[model samples]
Target: MGSVVFSIDAELGWGFHDYSNPPTDRIESARPGWKTLLEIFETYNVPATWAVVGHLLLEDCNGIHADHPAVDGWFARERGAWRDRRDLRFGPDLVEAIAEADAGHEIGCHSFSHVLFDDPRTTRDIARAELETAIEVARTFDIEYESFVFPRNAVGHRELLAETGFSCYRGAADPPESRLRRPLEKLLATIDPQRVELVEPTVDKHGLVDVPPSLFCFRFEGMPRAVVETLAEDPIVRQAKHAIDRASRTDGVFHAWLHPNNLQAERDARRMESIIAYAAEKQATSDLRIETMADVAERAQ
Candidate 1:
């Protein structure tokens, strides 16, 4: 049996702080849709990894925000633009809900304030503070984060994750390499449903394991409604099925990920259910083990 890991980037408003709209308008918490996700996982007896933002653990911030060492603030703005808007950042209730999910579900780190580690403006001091603060805050809730998912998938500071005591991270996507016409390869990969290679968990020289993802959960943001509806097979579902098949045949790992907020839309939620149902079927019939990212990392050790 192959392994399948579901990683959720569990940040509410903090994940969408860049927007001028109040986080309430753009982001959501565990109350409405997120609770349903927990219920679904419980029904299927599925385990997942939730890479929670550190600030969300704080019991309602009374005008408290991270004192980032970077002059530009978290995003490098001179005046902490979103600091006073505590409602947009704090969500301790959601943190608790995730902790109380499936007994063996993993709680991983998604940075303290969704800091972009790949930004050139972000210094080592800033990165260190972010990582350290996440660890410190998680401790308050008694959640020791062993796996991490980089904010916006901007990976950096590998040694820092190991230093901060993380066992593994979700590495960047791996596309098939091609020597034949590069542009054609890109177009084909984009247009066709092809099998993506399942990542074999590998340990870095720094002792941090890389448990990369196989495919993304369904999202319909960029495509037009008409095009999406007209497609013979939902692209995301097809991709996920292909990955699952490849992994099952090869005894590989198929890791799928998405954000809690993605399920705020009913369409996205249905797509997620479809994917989860397929996963459940694979688990019952195949040796497809559905595990948390930390669980996979532990096996590698």
Candidate 2:
């Protein structure tokens, strides 16, 4: 029985900085935000999944420089930042630090370059390669990870996930039926499982775990707490909580996710802190287990 999964996708911008390589951003640097989050989580003694992009797994910055620097999407270009001026050997240190601090903590994959899965159906080959590269990097780091969360929550390529030896993936959350759509939902008489499906850890015939990440809402740094409170009251949160709680009772798994960058935004720390506190406070210990997407998939198998 699992309680709830709290995971963080620590990653870079929309995609790889360079067409032929990955981002060169110092994503792992201990900025004020990272320090604040780490300190808070440490004090609270809460464990979360840190899913790193593949580029973050490497010790060297092989692809970031004046000759080539990650400017944007997986295949875009950008002018090199000052840090990029040095040898392209700046990334993944933050990931390594987290691994060293907590052995029970898990490292999952966010693809090699934070490849977007949303449309206008961006590059499919890049998505596959990013997924595959992330897997390879995870193995090289000896994490043996089985869970994947797409960058920006974009999802698709379910078959490719199964083929890549991943047991589970965190897909998009389903938007609850709007007030205007209530009549339709009643008429339909069923929730669209594909839109917000959560599966048992057991692998499919092809051996993939499907964990749908249904986000309630998110707020930036300066955004008021009133907004999230507004969200927590939404029937959707209660419904989602009930679903997860029931899963705990039924020997099924539950998961939820966030991103580190969300904390980097202005005034976002206060907003996210409230959420972290709420999630930590509401964490159920009953027949419930808390795990990262990777941890849940491993146990499911």
lDDT of 2 by residue, 162-199 (tens): 77777787756554453356655532322222233344
TM-scores, all models, native as reference? 0.85, 0.66
The residue-by-residue lDDT of candidate 1 on 1-301, one tens digit each, is 6888999888777787655554563365434556677767777778889898887887655333457675433453213655665555677777786677664688899998787888886788888988998899889988888999999888898889998899999987543353354865554554455645577899999998999887767433445434755866666777777777766667789899888776766666667777777888887888788889988999997
**lDDT, residue 72, model 2:** 39
lDDT of each: 0.75, 0.56
Displacement of the residue 29 alpha carbon in candidate 1, Å: 7.9
Off by over 4 Å in 2: 14-31, 62-75, 78-90, 118-124, 175-205, 216-254, 265-285, 299-301
* Candidate 2 overall lDDT versus native: 0.56
Single out the weakest 10-residue window by summed lDDT for candidate 2: 216-225
In candidate 1, stretches whose alpha carbon ends up further than 4 angstroms from where it belongs are: 19-31, 62-67, 75-87, 174-191, 219-228
